[model samples]
Target: MITGASSGIGRVAAMQLAERGWDVAVVGRNPGRTRDVAAAVSGTAFVADYNSLAEVRALATALLERYPRIDVLANNAGGLVGRRGRSVDGHEQTLQHNHLAPFLLTNLLLPRLVASDARVVNTASLANRGGTIRLDNLDGTGRAYLGGFPAYCNAKLATVLFTRELAKRSPVTAYSFHPGFVSTSFGHNSAFVRWGLSLLASRQISAEQGAQPLVQLASVDSLGAASGTYFDGLYPNGATARRAQDDNLAAQLWDTTARLVGLTDG
Candidate 1:
């Protein structure tokens, strides 16, 4: 199952996996585009907007009902919100959309994931290098809130931390990766983000190129690395921000996240 599969790397990856004879589930926010992608790939379509935790919960329930054994789950449906805002669930929008929403969905489906021995691929970014995960301030507001890309960076860092904690606590394998800056409409809402990416235009890669890492990680039989490893493309890279490497921080973040999202049993 791939969220954000209506466009960009997610769309390309969904197509590629379908061609490889995998039954892809294209999850997207836009109904029309999602249906188109699903039709193109001969896959299923599930719609959910990550801004709302209610929607994320519904998506999980739907997914659990549809797929008996999910092989791969790509939590790829997030972007850089231009300004500091609150989601319907009352989190910093970036924190909710990029981290909390996926966190909730994945945990909700944890039983199935463990049973199927599924691999989880989180599409994080090199911007994670700029992130600092403060368990006290995930909302990206007040003194800690540096809006725009910093918020995105922090959320991506949370993604990596989530992956690590998940592996530590579960039987399923989980991986997070930097997909190399890809040209996509991901940050179209943020003019600053667009300008920043434009400055690096020469270094940008295509969506297809970016999707290769996700494809490889999802399809490969053996990664030859631990479940919590983060990758730069297909290669394992341990050079994350200091906070991202902190197992104590990761565990704290996991517990905090569970409480924030109302996951009492976690």
Candidate 2:
């Protein structure tokens, strides 16, 4: 299953997986676009708004009920909503859409994923290096912040923490990835960022290029040996921050996230 699979890197990855004879589940908010993308790959399309936890939960239930097992879960449905905003649940929009939604869905689907030896891949980012996780201010309230990218980075950092902690708790392998600076719609909301990225044409790669490593990570047997590792591009080996690998921090993040998302191990 791949979230944000209607376009960009997720879409490319979905096509690649389908070509390899995997039954792909493409997820996105736009039904028409998702259906078109799914048709191109002969995969199923699911539409769900990540901004709504209720919708996310409903989608997860439907997916688990419909599919016997999910061999892979790619939590790639995330973004920065430009200015500061709040979800229907009263949490920051980015935190809710980018982190909390995926967090909840992954946990709800864990049993099915585990039953299938599923590998989970989270689309993390280089932006993570610029931000810090404020446990006390998980909602990004009570603080004057910059624009979108910093908050986006914080969400990605949280993803890595979540992946690491999840790896510790289960036999299922989980990894975070920096898909490189690909030219995608992800930065289109910011004119300056978009222009800058455009200027760096030589540096930015296509979504197909970015998706290569993600597909390799999900399908390759060698990656099975390393759980909770961060991948840069297609290389299984890369330098992740020491803080990202902190078990103590990862555990704290797990507990806090579980509470925030209302998922206790009952």
Candidate 3:
């Protein structure tokens, strides 16, 4: 299953995976766009707003009921909300959309994933280097102000830690990756960031280029053994940093996230 599969890196990944004979489930917020994408790949499309937990739960239930044997789950449905926004559940939008939604959906779908010995790929970012995991500030409400970049980094960092902890408890192999700042509509909602990113166009790669590593990781047999690792592009040679490797911290973050998302037992 690929979230955010309607455009950008997600779209590229979906197309490549389809060409390689993988039957994909494309999940996106826009029904029309997702239908277009799914039609292009001969796959199915699911529409759900990740910013809302109720919507995510309903989508998860539908997906589980429809596809009983999922071989791979790409948690790629995440982005920065333009301003400091709140979700329908009163949680920070970035935290809800990027981290908690994926976490809940992955946990809910673990049975299918493990039954197929699935490989899970999470789309983290290099911006995570600047993130600090503060259990007290998990919701970003305690902070005086929240910016798009910082909130995004924090959420992606949470993804890495969550993947690591999940690998520890479950039989599923998981990984998080940095796609190398691709040219996408990622920052389109923020004019300032868009302008700044445009200035760095020479350093950025195309969405297809960025999706290559994720596709390789998802489809390669060798990567099945390398669980709970962080990747820069296609390389998975090193750990994410001492703090990110802390299993205890990861557990704490997981608990906090569960509470925030109202998934007490997840």
Compare the candidates by lDDT and give the number of the best one: 1
**Residue 260 CA displacement from its true place in model 2, Å:** 1.2
lDDT of 3 by residue, 1-266 (tens): 99999998999999999999999999999999999999999999999998789998898899998887998899999988878888888888888888999999998888888998998999998777767788988777756433477788788889889988888889998988998879888877866668768788889999989999889888988864468888889888444545787789999998888887787854
Look at candidate 3 and tell me the lDDT of residue 9: 91
For each of the candidates, the C-alpha root-mean-square deviation to the true structure, in angstroms, is 1.4, 1.9, 1.8
Q: Give the runs in model 2 whose Cα sits over 4 Å from its true position.
A: 195-199
Q: List model 2 lDDT by residue over 153-262, tens digit each.
A: 78888888888888999878998889988888876776555666677788988999999878987888776447888888776646665577678888887888788888
lDDT of 2 at 263: 94
Q: Which rank order by TM-score, best down to worst?
A: 1, 3, 2
Over 77-190, each residue of candidate 1 has an lDDT whose tens digit, in order, gives 998888778888888888888899999999999999999999999989888889988788887567544338889989999999999999999999999999988988877888
Candidate 2, which ten residues in sequence have the lowest lDDT sum? 234-243
Candidate 3 clashing pairs, residues 3+ apart or interchain: none
Q: Which candidate would rank higher by lDDT, 1 or 2?
A: 1
How high is the CA lDDT of each candidate model? 0.91, 0.85, 0.86
What is residue 8's positional error in candidate 1, in angstroms? Answer: 0.5
